[model samples]
Target: MDDKSLVLPGAIFALFSIAMIWPPDEFVSAGATFEHLFYRWIGDFSLNIVEYQLRKILVNRVCVACLPALFSLYIILNVPPTALSTFVATAGLASMIMGLAYAFYTISTNFSQTRQVKELALYGGDVHRLMTEITQEYLEFANFAVSFAHSSREVVGSHWLIHITRFDFTIVNLTDVVFEVVRSATVDLNIERPNDQLQFLIIEAKIPHKNIKSFRFRVRTDQFRDLQDRVAAPIGMARNVILHQSLNERFVKAFVSCIDKNPRAVYSRLGELEPCFGCSSEIPNVKIEKRCTSIIEGARECRQCFCRPMWCVGCLGRIFAAKQEQERPDIWLDGQATCPTCRAEFCMLDVAFVVAEESQLDGNF
Candidate 1:
């Protein structure tokens, strides 16, 4: 549906049209008469065909040898065994050679876009599945904890309720036993979980005996802010939670490292920083000059994680576009965006461009 999708098909149609309307006499009388005038035009036209075929072969290497062989056979069958046949055969052979050469180049290009689509589907599915599982697990855990809290109140002679809050998943409690349970859950969820599904639960609870009436505990995730929006309860109650932690450190790291390692991190103690986490050559402070202005100019970050570099607008746009295409087959909502690093939901409009200001440049220097 996009302009890029139409490119190859449109080119094929134009080539087919040209070939259909091509006069047979033009081929036969190519060098027979008006050698000076027709010769250059014929040569140019033949070169154009060769170039076009070569380009096509670059896109699909499978067609390289096959197309040339088929065309060679056609030429051999059509042309009589005569002096003129030699010239036509030579032209056909030349086209075939060019096709073969370009075919070798196809390996480097993304000739099969289907591979990218498949990868996107798998990546999106895996993230979604992980998020669903984590949420379910958290819900179950919260229910158990709440029940334990109520039962403990009867034994302790003090009323205690877990009041879960935002960000850190902090849990407030009157008893040391409950505090330990909550702390263990937070650590396990944040640090011990799979690198790809790293997340923390935000919980709040009341300390019945103390002046400090409430306490909070947070299980940290890679994109805590993003998860906060997706997983939080409607009434800010822990039991009424909905966990949706789609983005994780591993996914973001893979995506960022897919193209290149962060140059800054490569030399620094950071080793290899994730570009999806807002580390890249394009960041103005990095002092690295990139040739692609679109990438450099379009850099943006999640507002929730202000200092951390998130993604170039172009890259994020493609990701958002791909997700939209995958989810809503009929309609695309361009404005919607979710940070893979912090799991924050935001509109495309909220993405701020990285502009190199005079003061900032001076500060960097």
Candidate 2:
């Protein structure tokens, strides 16, 4: 695949904007210059002077150079079946005559225009939105691969000690306009032990497959911070994009639709809730936590405690014994419920008392 590039559209937009404002043929043809120029030059002096800035060297500088640069770009973007023919012919015409003349001025003064031509030579110079997109992609790739080994992390196997790696980025093939391939990179992932300086390493970068024409890339960290940052993050995002699983407008609407109805699940979306299905049950259509919101966060107890159903009979029996103990002047802890994780005993009756007390506050207020 081609590497990403951003030359074509920028060149086209910039050139075309210049062309539409230029003076006509009679004014541009050397001898018939200025005061005898086309009617359009009369109103916009700034626009007129801009067209003639390089005219001393090339009389039809803006017209001959910019128009074809633009029209070639148009053919590149418009991409009609016969558009390639237009671009090849127009680019050839633009290059031979005034191309060098305009390019010399562009390079000597504001050189961005000259670089665009170089990018065209690499990426086929057709106006395309893809140029910007591909450039952004290469930048993102560089942000990861540039620092492949040395970010910071705890080397888990070595007694949970912290360590940082050192690395550097190098570009290999800026020549390939289509794909900005970094041919070599060096990374050092270990801390220097006294005089035992850590050795730097060159990663054999393996881009899976690419198709790029022109791209601008920036150097970024090659060292990784964590396992997910190194491995899972990139693959997961790519997989989601490939699967068409973006959380866009349609997904948002569906999520809102689910939230409004109040389903049995705390969160309407799958995978959002932190749950233990081993502790959950389907008790007909009974909803849990109708009265107390606190139940959602910590109260692992289910429908029985909420509704005081048959299963809660075991708890009620324990509470009854404790109540009897209170009447007989004997100290006793309230109904005990065992926590499954820690096997710790909790006073279920005390929890019920707190819930009842909180509910009473609402009435008093």
Candidate 3:
């Protein structure tokens, strides 16, 4: 092939290398990009240490071999047997030889070591079974959940089972969690205000080997409360894990506090209360009544919502959150959002938690 034709292939190879090494969020969301590219040689599963290591080694060797070969091919094709071309060709050839020798040495030394001997022996038993079972709960771009027979927990990243455990047959237990550290820093430093919306909940616990292991979960900024009603196994084992100082939990608490401070309304009859329009399961217990002093022109100010109690506290909190500037969560508490039913502008102070008073019917009737 001509030297000009090599430009496209070289660019493609560079991108492929980047994706393999430090994959972008997009590539990870695509699912098994690295494995799919080298499926023939690397195989599909990297569940265990042996498979993972072998795939790594194979990919490294291929890259090492291909890089020098491309360099040599370019020089050979472009330059016609000149002294410079000969020297370049020789250098490329020698480079490939050195790379091959290094690959051979690495492979030979790795195979001789018995570090993974125990792991290899236990792969077919409980190790493989745990990974296989956890794999079913794996969701790309979503929270990684590894559910065990006794407990279910959310992992930091997608490859936690393969990377962290390395198929050691260790059952991850966070039952004795002493404390959870919540981390929240501005994702974009250029922004003046520190965005509390972007946060991570970290839980540190001792794994099988008594080694301190930390599992981090990315907090969902959009949702005030974590959705526990998933199709996967119940993760109630770590239910209280995010309750301590989590930004999401803090948002919910702040919203509820605001609702409590607002003017409370009581219904004479319990029959007037209806199910929340957002989530049909819960009864609407909150009414939007303009209690804020802010009076701005247009639909920017807090206005009374003539609509009935059509939203529960949880649903109203979520709606309030959705209207605020996601990038600037600092102004979320003071932001105004339109009511879902009447489109009347309302702020956090306008939402009131309603209590229904039941009236007893006299027997004399």
Candidate 4:
């Protein structure tokens, strides 16, 4: 075959390498496809075991690195010995060597059976206990990270903290560790509202013999309170760090609490209510009606929203919060916000539950 024939195999190999490292949504979402292709041999191995997961990761990497090399070698053997074939052979050999070296390094650092000294360095005095904790029952691996009840394998543990990446796994003691929450600069405008951005919890630990010093873990604003209750160590009072609630999130809670006290708006049971426009996962259970005494009290009159009930309470709360002055959060509830579907203005007092059937209110509503 001509040198031009190499194009197909080369392109295929390149795509394979990319997919192995950064798999597309189909590979991730389709569990059967992902398991059959990647973990076909090791599918039966218990994910709870740290050793099994480490071995799985190491095997995956080796495969990722060596598969391309094997493809290159196949091309060299099939095609005539040209300069292109010679170059392919050289690249194949290099790839094999790199993969083997990485495998060896991983075995030495992560595997206790291979290198006892590294294990001692990792666990120190609690070697036996910590080793047992890690190996016995870890949660299912989520992208090389495990999730326990309070902490994750990639973040905090009861006594230890671990950071697992594609290439490295670093673990450190929780002793003398400092935690700080900071605002994340990277914002997904499509996913998050303009005012409510993301935040991350930084875990800085003192590792004696490790190059890694800190790990950044994502913490959702709504789950912060629960996290605080679960975490043993108090968050550090450091400069430029905040563990307080995001304005939008705080407003959501308050909005829900206030609107819950208001009377329910009766909708016709004949009409089928659709899923929320803001978050499609939930049913539209809220309506914007002028039930508040603001109009009688001589405040800004709240117009009755003629739009259909198309928003959940949580989503409506979010929209209401997002429309308010971001800087003036104190006056947020007292202020008015225009309905997302209709331009009619309404306050938190006007938000009400949509009850189609009075009987369903006790159970599903």
Which rank order by lDDT, best down to worst?
4, 3, 1, 2
Q: Rank the candidates by TM-score, best first.
A: 4, 3, 1, 2
lDDT at 187, model 1? 27
- Candidate 1: worst-modelled 10 consecutive residues by lDDT: 148-157
Clashing residue pairs for model 3: none
lDDT of 4 by residue, 83-106 (tens): 887788778878888988987876
TM-scores, all models, native as reference? 0.19, 0.19, 0.45, 0.53
lDDT of each: 0.36, 0.31, 0.54, 0.64
Off by over 4 Å in 4: 1-9, 31-48, 97-110, 113-122, 125-128, 135-155, 180-183, 191-193, 196-216, 220-229, 234-248, 256-365
Query: How does model 4 score by TM-score?
Result: 0.53
Model 1 quality (TM-score) = 0.19
Q: Compare the candidates by lDDT and give the number of the best one.
A: 4
**What TM-score does candidate 2 get on C-alpha atoms?**
0.19
For model 3 the TM-score comes to 0.45
Candidate 1 lDDT tens digits, 1-365: 23243346446645643432332355335532222223332243223322222232233333323344454454466545555445545665777777666545544453233222232233335633433343343443222232121111111112222232111122222242222113213223334333324334554444345434354445443333432323322214344444543333333344334223222211121223354423232222221122222221233433343334445533554455555434342233333445565656544334433333433322312
In the range 174-286, model 2's lDDT, one tens digit per residue, is 22212222322333332442221222222122322323222223222212222223332131221212111111222323423332343221212222332222212211111
Tell me the tens digit of each residue's lDDT in model 3 across 105-139: 75677543323333333334564454454444343
